[model samples]
Structure formats: C-alpha cells, structure tokens
Target: MRVGRGAREDRADARDIEWPPSARSPGPAGRAGAARALAAAGASRHRARDFAWPGAHGAEAGVSGCGRRNILLVIFDSLGEGALASMADALPVLSGLRREALRFAAAYAPSPEGGPARASLFTGLDIPVHGVWTDGVALPERETTVAQRLAACGWRTWLVGRRHLAGVSNWTTEHARPFEYAHLDWAHGPLHRSRQNAYLAWLQDRAPAAYAEIFPTQANADDTDCPDWQRAAMSALPDALSFNRWVGARSCELLASHGRDGPFFGIAGFVIGETMGAAPRQSSPCEALQERALRQADAALGDILRQLERSGLAETTALVVTAARGSVAEADTDAPMQESAIRVPLMIRSPGLAAGTVAQAVSTIDVAATLYALSRVPPPRRLQGAPLLATGPGSVGRGWALSRLRRDHGWKTALRHGRWKLVVSHGDPDAGVQPGFSLFDLREDPEESRDLAADQAHQGMLETMIDLMIDARVAMEDRTEPRIASF
Candidate 1:
C-alpha cells in the first residue's frame, strides 16, 4: 500500500547526502588502542574485587565484572525514564525486559540531545572532557571511541544504526557518524531505514526475491529499500517492515555471524519512543506513536534474544538497553538536561551481574567505561565515568550525574547530586555566573517545577552543586590530553 508521498528529491544526489546537511570531516583516526591494550594486560578476572563505585569525580570503580562477552547495545533514540511510569501502556515488552534485567533507576544522558549524549557514551567522558558539547560538531578523531578499543582487543565491532558516528550531517543521518568499523563493508549510514545497510544488503543478496516481496509495495519499488528511502520515522512504519524490526533482523544476523566463540560489540540505534522526550517535534503525540515504536523495538529485541539463545550466546553477551535520556518531555519545551532526561532508563543483563535496580545516578558517559571493563580492556586514564555492574553490595551510585547543553559557542552544565540538581549556563566567561542558572530538589519535584536555587534552606546544597560543576569542568578541561573513547 502507498503509505505517503515519496519525498521529492533527485536520486542522483541521494547517495552523497550526509547528516547535519553540511557536516565536514575532521581528523579521523582512533588512538592506537593504548588504554585498551593496557587494560588487557592488567585485567585478570571478569568480576570486580569489591564495591568500588566511582565518587563525584569519575574515580576508579575498580573494574567491572565479566570478560570477553559480546556486547549488544540498543539505543532507543530519546525514549526516557517516563517509559517506566504506569502511564506507559505502550511499552509492555520493554517493561518486561526491565523486570528481568539489572536496572539503573537514575541513569542520565549527559547532554540535551543525541549528538552530544552519544558522544559521551562512545567516549566514556563528559561534555567538557570529550569536547563534543553539541550535535553537528564531530568528535575529534584523536579521541578513541569504545568501538575502536573493543575492536583492537580482537572483538568484532559492528555498528548497526543511524546517527553521527563519523560526521555525516544530512537530515536523515543527523546522528550518523564516520564509518569506523574495523572490518565491515556495509558499515555506512543510510538516508532512512536507519543505520545497518550492511546487514540489509546482506539480506537482499541472500534472498533477493524474498526481500523484494517482504512488503507488498516492493513489487513496483525502484529503490528496493523503500522504507529506508522514504525517511519515515521508525515509529511511523508498519510492524513487518519497521526500522525496529530491522534492528532485530540485523542483530540476529550479527549474532549468527559471530557464533558462540567470538567476541563482538554491536550498537543498534533506532528512532522510537525516546526521540519524543528530547524533541517532540522530531516526533509527535508521544504516547501513541512511542507505544507503537516500543512494540516494534521490543519485537526486534525478542528476535535478538532468541537468536542469542539459539546460538548459546545469550549468557556470553553483555546486553545494554538504554536511551539517550529519560524524558525531555515538557508541555512547552523538549530539553534532555531536564530531570526526566537526566534520569533515563539503564538496564544491564550480563553474565556477571544479577538482576536488580541500581539506585545510583549514572550518566551515558559511563557506558564506554563499563564496556571496556566488561571486555577486560584497560579504559583510558582520561575516562571520567565509572563502571556500574562491577561493584559489590552496599555500593552507592556516583555522588553526582552530569549534564550539559550548548546554547552557542559557550554552554551550561547541570549537576545532579542526590535529590538536588543545579543547571548553570554560560555566565561571564571569567566569572561564569552571569546569573544563568536554576536549581531544583528532584526528590520532591522530579518535573522541576519548583526552583530551590534561591531558597535559604537549600543554600548549602546549591553551593555544593556549584562547586561540583566548577571543579568538574576545571578537571575535565585541564586533563585534555587525548583520552580514548568511541561514538
């Protein structure tokens, strides 16, 4: 069936189109796996020695548990913490997954949107540390992404999604990145159908006739990957041919290819419920559409898990399912630095960790560090976030979770210290307190309607927040000596 009008465009120029529309390539080369090599030398057991969670300043969380397990990371664009709410009737499958997984109740994105947030995850460092304070700007090549580090450790790294990994700035590839996989030919970004063309092309070549007929419209289709060419959000697609379904299909392919013995790292990025939180206009009617996306994504997830089980790799793979933020969803604005966004969902289903909810406040930056530890690779000294699942009993979350947003050349940073959160934007560059700030008691007002910054009662907390932000920035910038990371 004809779903909607095909966006009018010249096919001749389609392949050349990049995300960010005009994004330029920067120096593109990962550091020579120095940190990972070091980690490999020193790392012994797959599990942690004790409960060594990182402190306010991204200290050593000791080392994570488990080793050489395949990594399966599924990032659902902007689906935030709101999915855990009772009103999230659309996320039945995800809710079920969370029930069985080791959950992080207060996970954060570290940035207001996908570009910077993902940069944080790939690098294991915050905005100030990585210098990827915003989208559109490519993370400098000098920084080693997690994928690079993992690949260096004999792990087959496969990136299966769209979004900036390298620096394509076309409308569709806004989150797209440079083709950085060590050994994959189809590892480039597509205009639609999202990132994983390598897998889709493999499917097409494996059974061209069947693929051509998977959807009814393909009978007369010209582009072959019609759903992809249409640029429709994954939420807007039919279940049989949805982007989420493709995620499952691609993940299954990757799992099948790797088998049970090999080590691998895979990232499946899908536009689903999460995008609604940070930028509603990127999606609309968040509840209904996100519900559908969640179902499709869950279906893909189920397909993946089944593949893992069949391959006997389920227990060997360390799976991470999280979104960029919890929910930037507000009535008026969609900003990820808000409490909901800063408190997105984080679940870890790994061989070393048991099922439980981590009440600690972790940020997206920690993912790379966790992955490195899980792979038994040495994380870079410059990495800021600490590993989670590795800690023993009685371990608390970091003293704070960090978030930042770039309004222009300058930026503002948010600090979430326990129940209180302070957002400080660019003040006088010298003073850095041009009065652009807000503070809230998240325990009481998770929605952040109440500003406790000016209150006498929270004055001490406010000072603590300010000190945390100031000290962290200074530390981050001062140590810009090329920390290794991935995006």
Candidate 2:
C-alpha cells in the first residue's frame, strides 16, 4: 500500500480553522433535554460506541465472512456535472484516479432536490415508492432503507455528513437514526450560517484538534455563503470553511477506525449544492462558492483515499463517489425535470469493475440496489432501483432513464432513452403546451438548447418515450405488488 500524507491532511494547515463564538452559549437545559431524549432512545450510548470495525454487528457480519469488499459511498451535495468534469485539471488526485473510475456520462438524479434524491439512494426505490419527493417529506418508517437492509444482512452501515439524512421529518420514524453511527441533533450557527454544531460534534468525537481549529466558534445566517437569491434564511453556525473541513476530517477518522474483519458500508454525504439554495443561478455569487467548495471537496476526497490506502483497506474497498443533485438552475426556470436540474455526475470504482470506461445512463438509486446484490443482501420490498453493475456497459437496452419532479413550482417529467431525451411538464399538458415536450438528440445537441418536440419526424419517438416514462411511473407506484427481477 502507498503510505503518505493525504490531501486532506495537507489542507488542514491551509486555513485558520477555528470554532466561531456563539453569542448565547447553549445552556445546560438544552443539552440536558437532548441527553434525556437520546438516553431514552439509547442514542447517546449508541453514538459513543466505536465504529471502525467493519461489519461490527447485524447481518453484514454474516455476509462478509472475510470482509473482502468495503463500500465507500461518497456524495457531493448539489454538485454540477460540468463543474466536476472541468475540475480534472485543478484536482490532480481525482484526475489521476479517473482513469480507474467508471464515469456515467448520462447519470441522473431521481429527483431535483436532496431529500428526494437521497431517499431514492438509501431506499433503492424511486420517489414514487419512497414518497420522499421533497425536502421535508418524511420517509415512512415502515419502508426499509438500503442502509437498514445492509445492516440487517451484516454490513456495518455508517452515515456521516449533512443533516438532510436524519432531519426532523425522517428522524421521527424507524428510518430516523437508522445508521449505527450518525451525527445527529444539531442546529445552524448562532450569528451567521458559518458555524455548524453537528460538524463540531462529529469532529469532537473523532479529531478534536481539527474540530477546534475549524469551528473556533458558532455562527448564524450572515456567516453562511448562502446565495442572495436563497428563498430561505441562512442559519448561524460554523462558517463554510470550518464546517466543510470538520466534516472532512471527522469522516476520515471514522474510516480510519473501521475494523478490517468484514465488509463495510460507509456513506460520506455532504450538502454541497444545497448549502446555499435549492439551485443557484448561473451568474450567482454562490457560483464562486460552489467552485471553491468543489476544490476543497476534491482535496478532502484525496485525503480519504489516502487514509484508506494507509489502513490497507483500499484494495478491497469498493469506492463509489457521486453527487446528490445538480446545483445549477436556469433563470426563470423552475422546472425540476430540466437537464440542468435533474442531471448529476456518477462515478464508481471497484475491484471487479471495468476501469476507466464510462457507464451508460445510470441513476443514483442504482447504487443501493447494486450494493445489495454485491453483498448478497435482500433488498427492501419496495425498492425500485436495480443493480448497475449487472446492467453492464452499453446494456441500458431500455434506452432511456426516467426522472420525475413533484415539488415546488417544478412539476415535470423526462425520459432519456439513448441520445434522444424528451422533457414534458406535468402542468398544463393539454393546453397546447408549446415547450412542454422538448426532444433533444444528445449526440448532436448535448447542451439541450433547441426544442425538437414540434418536429413531425421525431413525434413517433417522443410518443414511444412518453409511454415508457408513464409505464415506469406506474410500475414504481405499484411497488407494493412484487415483480420478478429480469436478471
């Protein structure tokens, strides 16, 4: 194994990482209340336990007899497809590793936002079944998440990063605090959104010095790098710099501490794009913030990789790095099904995967299903995502991927079947929708500038694609009824 300091370690010294000061110190009452709730739920003691050992508990133990393959799921919140591709030059570590990675050229998010996107990822089901199509919608407790299933099957599942996963809505159900190691129950900064308590708590548990340096104090809305167009107010907490750094270091610490005996599942989820707003305008100031954050994230990723190598876990670990949703939004465009909103980057690198070659039209929801299949774990009954690995390259015979949007003013749907993509808005479909259905032959117009839906020649193709999309939605909504797997 190559042993050396990773990019994350080097960057730690690059900033004046400090805790932001909180005007009103969090009183003992709040801490006491939190402690009482956690104690009642056994969460306090659970969070205190060690998690480094791979497949430490549950069904994962039985599946990974030798702990042969570890799954490292890395998510960059609200990342842009074009931006990640452009960073090949600035981020040498990722660039160097890209050749060994499986790039999904036309990968997409199941939904336009984080909660829905992540819900699809964790449940291995699309939004229709998971029903978490928006930020606040709670994932029903009765539904089983891929994390829960994997844990049940013997993989030590750990979720670390951002509060979206275990937010108030999802937290109230069994899916809430579902992971064995979760950084839960924290608030925004006191003054500006610069200070993040959750990030601090996580750091304190793993790398205390790094935490102290990054978050010197708490913050509030003004401290955040939130874009001016943001519909919601920013919270006071750790500044962006401190929050990101703390998240990176703590995640690495957790990875470093894993046991080497069995297969493990680790999700390093970061709220990259969503931190500022739902979708920042192209010319928004947050563009600079996104750019810098991506670079910082790239550095952090390098560090995590180095840690894995140092721990001698890289060889066996299956590393899958991707984004939750796109951060780019067109001006005057609230349609979530638009390419800029629904499309995201997907990259996977595993021991047995086809190295360096890009995969065709995969979706984020496929990750959980693929992992379940690889780990010999039975997925939840409601899961709609299938195994990407089994699909293989150029085998997306279905020709197109489906996307649905049902939140905010963004109500639309799309079908990406091969190079021909059709986007249709659900609102006012019959009132002679002019741009309601846009057809783009991606091979020729990858940017999706012109609308070819009016063309008579492609009408048949568009109709067929629409049928496929509707069928998919129907099939997904009927998940309570079991269907046989083609594979």
Candidate 3:
C-alpha cells in the first residue's frame, strides 16, 4: 500500500497543482475568458440557448432551449436496475420520475466496483484509461472531471454525501481535488467517525441525543467485530436524522437558496442500500434491509424532486439518476463480471426531451458527455464518450457496453454487444491457472444461468464475441493525447 501524505504535505501539494485558467481567476473576467473559449469551439452561450432536439419544437414548446440548464446528478450506490424494478411500487417517487424520464434499458457501469465506476462517470474515460480499477485507488489529479469543466464555465458546483474519488479510511478523511467542487458536504458513510464527516456533524448539531446514542466518541467503544448489518441498523435513525435524508435535505437547501444569476451543477451521492452489509446471514434479512433502505432513499429522491418543482427550477434543470454499480442482491455469484454486478439503472429527465425508453446499450461514462451536452460546454478532447443527446446515425446509443474488474479476487472483463455477452477471465499465470470464458445470450437467458462457452453448437458465436471484445478493447485505448506526428 502507498503511504498517504501528511496534512501539511497534502495542503502544499494541492496549492502546487496547476489549476485551470478559469479557476485561477474567480470573477467575471475568468468567466468571460471561458465564454470566449466556448465561442472559439463553436459552442457559445448564445448558441446554447438556440440548441434544440432534432424534430422537436422550439422555445414556445418548452423544450430545454431557453439557456444552459442547471444539472442535478443523483447517484444511489448499489441500486441496480433489477432492484429498482422490483421495488418500483414501494418507490413511488422514482416510479413517477421513470414515467417522465428517458430511461436506458441496457446501461452498464465502466467498472464493477464503486471507485473506478464513479471515476468513469466523472471523467468519461474507461477504467483502464483512468487507472482507478478498484476501491481505495485515488483518481489522478491530472484527469479533469465534468464538475470541474462546468465550474470553469461559470457554474456553481457542489457535492453532497460520498465522493470516493480518493480512498476513504478510518484514520483520515478523503481529500478533495482543487476546484473540483465549490461547495462540499462530504460524508464517507454514516458510521464513519472522520471529523470531516458532515453527516455526523449535522447529527451532533441537530439531534444531539441521537448522535450521542449512535456515535459514542470513546476510542474503546469499538464495534469492529459487529456485523455490518447490525451496525447499519444501529445507525439507521429517524427520517430527519438518517444519512440519506440529510443528503436530500442539503441538496434541497442548495437548490432553494440558489438565485437565477447563473446555472448550477450539483451531485447528491446517497449511500443507504450500499451499506446493508458486506455479507448477510440470510438472504431474507439482507433483502429486507435493502428494501427498507431503498424506500428511505426513494423518499429522499422525492424530497429533491419536490424541492426542484417548488423552487421553480424543475423546468430548467436536467436531472440524472444512476448508480455506480449493482447491488449484491442482484449478482448471482461473488464474481464481479456477471451482468447483474455491472448493469445499473440510468435515467435522464432533461428539458424539451420526450420521455421514453432507450433500448440501446450505454455506459455510465456517457453521463459526463451528456452533462457537457446539456451545459453547452465543449467537452474536452480527452472524453471517450459521445453526447447522449446526439441524434441520427453515429449517435451515443451504440448497442454495446464494456465493464472491467481488476482486483485481488481476479482480473475479468465483460463485453455486451447486441444480444450476446462475453466475459473473459484473465487468470493469474503465476498461480498456474488457465484463462476462462463465459458466454451468454441475454435474450434467451437474461438470468445468465447457463454458460455457452463449452457448447459445440455455440463455438462460432463464441469466436465472434471474442473478436468483438478484442476490437472494443483496442478501440477504447487511451486517446487523451493522441500522437500527432510519427516522429
């Protein structure tokens, strides 16, 4: 493991890192320069106002063409598509939003783990390109996030709840990158005792009794031996004091307090279902815990949406709801390469866009591209994803998604193209284990019960999928700084 920097060294390193030109100057002059840069890229603010969906009506029709819209990206950790569908009736708010949102039927995370998956969502780059292949891996400072890009273009960026861009440990709070977020309310988890945890601080200030009962500050009162489920249950307080509710309340406050001066970008990261437990004694208890957490999270989602409507920002705000990775309940095995492990819920409710299901397969990395499209900011050349709103041929609704998992458990890669899904296990040669393959026709077996890799009849299909996977990996090779000259 790499040694973490001391507080003083961390501060110095943050100061030494070069910020973007717009970030260096915080007033109108910086904004104007960013505007000029947008103009040079043929995406001026004025042109952004005129932007409209193809075959869609103009300003009179209430399409999102008025100006740059505020963006609220809500990520529910471990909330998979299956879980959402199964709990739809219990989650009235999410169900209602789904009716009026553009839902992606086949959305996959870039990685089957939280850190790399979120890194891809933020940077629009694959896990390999970003090098955050597992949890605890720090995102390189050089990679620019969509939040930074929007902040550079004069948007007020805020982050509430968890942001696993850096490793979260019991010893220290995770550090934020410079100018990454203008305002931050960070809490790694509800039970975390990090002094920087905003949730616990809020509990202490608002509900001292509950805070004292739940979080005794004595170092000897260690509950490390207790199961995660029991700990989560103990920490799960009333609606007003719950971690998810706190995140929702803060996001609503941010939205309510904002003026009409400039567009804003906020990320509300909720961690309820994610902490149900690392391992459950029984599936029933785990399922029940997850269900309860989802219901709470649903209420939180409702709070944010109602605040948006009540504050009159609903019409001009683009709401994106997705997950970093799937839940343990959805996965059939402990392996991270399964479809259930990476397939997540993704939906976008933007101005002027019609609500419907998009059948094309897409990756969460596309969320970054979609944000840039909504804000009318020219996405950096390093972005590997295309705008989700782009229409006609060669659009982002490509019928394929890729997910990678490289961790202590194993190195696995999964590719979904058309109806076929292929998973390749690059076993450790040093361990004397040979590589393995698993193929499934999702249409025929959505549960992925039977693997067709050894079937004689499907040999041709397996070879074709192998070739497609190889081509995809080659295509996704880092082009952030493409070679201009052979010399």
Candidate 4:
C-alpha cells in the first residue's frame, strides 16, 4: 500500500504553485444547485464506506467551506496500457494505484492521435459534433469545454500544460479566451518557448550515437528507431520546462487555497512521449531509460498529489490519470492501430467514485461528463459520451470507438467494437490500399495476429460491425455541418 517513501515531501517542494483565474461569483441559487448536485453525485458524503477497500484508512465526509471540490487531471501523451504493463518494473507509482483507484480495463480513445481525442474530452462531443477531426483543427467558438462550463458556474478554472484544442487560432474573447493560467508548448523552442529546439539538442547531445545509428538509410531516415524520436524531432521547436513546472506548482497552490472556499477545476497535461522521430535519452534502446522517462512523469504526478494532501485537499480532490492517446506498439510489425495506440491506463479517484474496477468499454469522450457529474455542473447536452461514475462493470462490450486518419486522397476511418474491428479506407482502396476489416477474439488473440474476417462464421458478424461503423461515421459528418461558423 505504501507506494513510495517520502514521495509526499518530494511533491510539495517540486515547484511553485499558481492560482486559477477568478470568475464572477455564482448567486445563492446556483450555489444551492451545485451543493445538491455534489451531494447527489456523492461528493459531499464520501465516508470510508464509500470505498470498496475494507481496510482503507477511512475518513468522514469532508466538504471544506471552500465551496466546490478540486479536480487535478493529469494526462500523459502516448502512454498505453500495454506499455504500463510492460514497463511495470519502472512505473511502480501507477501500478500501485490499481488497488485504490477505479481501473477501466477497456478504456478507449475516440480518435487515434492528440488533437481529436483531446477535442472529444473537452467538448464532450464526438469528432463530428465538434468539427475537430484532427490536430490543428479548431474547436468551434460556440462549443463549451468542461472548464468553461465550470467557470461560468463560478468555479475558478485554469488549464495548464499542452493546449491541443483543434481550433485555437480563431479563439474568441467570450467563449474561448485564454485560460486564467494557460500553459502550453506552441511548438518547440526555449524552456518557456519551443519544444523542438530542446528535442533537437537532446538528439545531438544525449544520444548522438543512437541518432547516428538509427538514421542510416533514407527510407527510414525520416523514421528513427530510437523510442523517443518524437522528442528528438521536437527539439527543433520549443521548451516546456517552465510550463510543466509552473502548472504542477500552481495546481497544488490552487488546491490548497481554493479547496476550502469552493470547488476549482485544474487540468495538468504533459507530452512525455516522443514528439518527433528522435530525442536523446528517449531514443535509447535501454528499456531502463524509456521506463525512467515514464517513471519521472509518474513522480511528477506524485508531487501534485503531495501538494493536495499537504493542504488537506487530498480526500476532497478528484484526481484522474489518463492519456490523450497511447504510444505505438509492436514496433517489430506494421500494425499501429492495435491496443497500444488507442488503449490507455485510466485511474479515477474521487470522493464520489466507488472504488473498484470497471471493465466496460469507455471512451475519452466520457471524461467531461464524469467531471461535470462530480462537480455538480450540468454536462453540455451535445456530448456523445455517457456518464460512467458509479456504473458497475458492464456486460455489453457492444459499443464501438472510432478513429480516423487524414490521408492525401481522403480520410480513413476505423471502428473498433469489442473484439471485432473494421478499417475503411474511403479515398482509394482500389489503388491498392483499400479498406479492410479485421476481426479477432481480443481475449484469445490479444496481439491481433489472426485475422478472422475471412472466416465464414464471422462473415455476418463482421458485416454487421462494418455497417454499424460506417453509420457512426456518417452521423458524425452530419452533426458537424451546423457548427462551421462557430470557430
């Protein structure tokens, strides 16, 4: 149960804290509603009995006069569930939380990469509703974020770390103004500037030999074997140290100062995985180095936790550890869309959450709903994800998650429903790489080595799954038609 020694102290002193932007006060009626919502969500009455852990050091329901509960969401980029299991030796902090936190065995991302997945989380809408199909796609100004909704309800909301919203360029003053304390790495530069420059420098210095060793041929010259190639590629851009440190310190400060008065919303995101095809330490073949990067990221999370506990905000804080997306797995093969790229480790610990494991197929889109449900804020009606709090392990793994790739000719869409998945290459499958359907018994064939689409018995089932997937994609396209002007 004791995950780390003196890890608590290491957290409090890690960095300086920053408070969130204060908004107009909520009227008495709104406050009452918030209270009711919180109580209904079980935030106000989290007795030791609330936890499924029998021997846990239980505490009485503690709602500080501060008004609202605090949320510290830590999302690591490209950290997959398989990677967590593979690197279990290095990631003790995360593995340890399996006992106390609710683990969703089949957590999924609606999109394949950062932009669309994060867009889904923030807007509570599917890709089509938000119109943010990929990275750099702008979020329509009219759509609301979970943070924006909470802020409007009188909660001080500050967003720290990488800002990967699809449509940030057309930001408006009223709905999409800068977060109270916005921390982002625009590209790559200085500690507070570019992430690319640091990455390039790391590549040149830390593991220059690996860089030289991997980029021997032009076909793969652009593709380096070093695991941290993204980091090295990002060296040509900006630095995110101050932003990372600032966000961490500020989260603790905000939790301590605002936790007693009312609830606050804080989001701390990190791009721990490689951004480009190269980076020095991240590119090392040594599994120890790769794991160390992940563990350091975990340690950073521990720091944030220590701050909350130090300020007596631990029990009242809702801490969610997740990822925007997962890293590539099976580097030995050509497969990139397996469980590694889409499946992530999800750990949700809140006063309102019942401690246990949830084996249902959930997506990133559900995150906003969970936050709003816990904070007493109403989720935007347009959200596509369902509320997952307090839900028991589901028997139906019937829901499918969608992923898309923007190709030169057209867009490629993928639909994964439980054990069967279908990939449709819309633009030019006739040119050679046409759309394909892959079916596997995930429980029996976790590696996806066997393709069952050719099986006669599974033909009907595959067709049914493919039809459903195509229908979902069509629905998404139709939903975004009206939001074209918002951005």
Candidate 1 per-residue lDDT, tens place, 322-418, comes to 8765544452353335665556777888886778876656677778878876766666555666676654225643435677766542356777655
Please report, as a residue range, the 10-residue window in candidate 3 with the lowest summed lDDT. Answer: 280-289
78-150, model 2: which lDDT tens digit per residue?
7667666676788776676666677776778887666778788777777877778666677777677766776
Off by over 4 Å in 3: 1-66, 217-232, 274-289, 330-332, 391-396, 482-487
Better of 2 and 3 by TM-score: 3
Which one wins by TM-score: 2 or 4? 2
Model 1 Cα shift for residue 249 (angstroms): 1.0
Q: Candidate 1 lDDT (Cα, whole model)?
A: 0.57
Q: How would you encode candidate 3's per-residue C-alpha lDDT over 36-58 as one tens digit per residue?
A: 33223222221232233232232
Each candidate's number of clashing pairs is 35, 60, 1, 55
Poorly placed runs, candidate 1 (over 4 Å): 1-67, 86-89, 171-236, 273-289, 330-336, 390-393, 427-434, 478-487
Q: Cα lDDT for residue 38, model 4?
A: 27
Candidate 2 — which residues are off by over 4 angstroms?
A: 1-68, 166-175, 178-196, 200-241, 274-289, 329-335, 394-397, 428-435, 480-487
> Candidate 4 on 255-288: residue-level lDDT in tens?
6666354666777765555432122122211111
lDDT score, residue 302, model 1? 81
Candidate structures ordered by TM-score, highest first: 3, 2, 1, 4
Model 4 lDDT, full chain set: 0.54
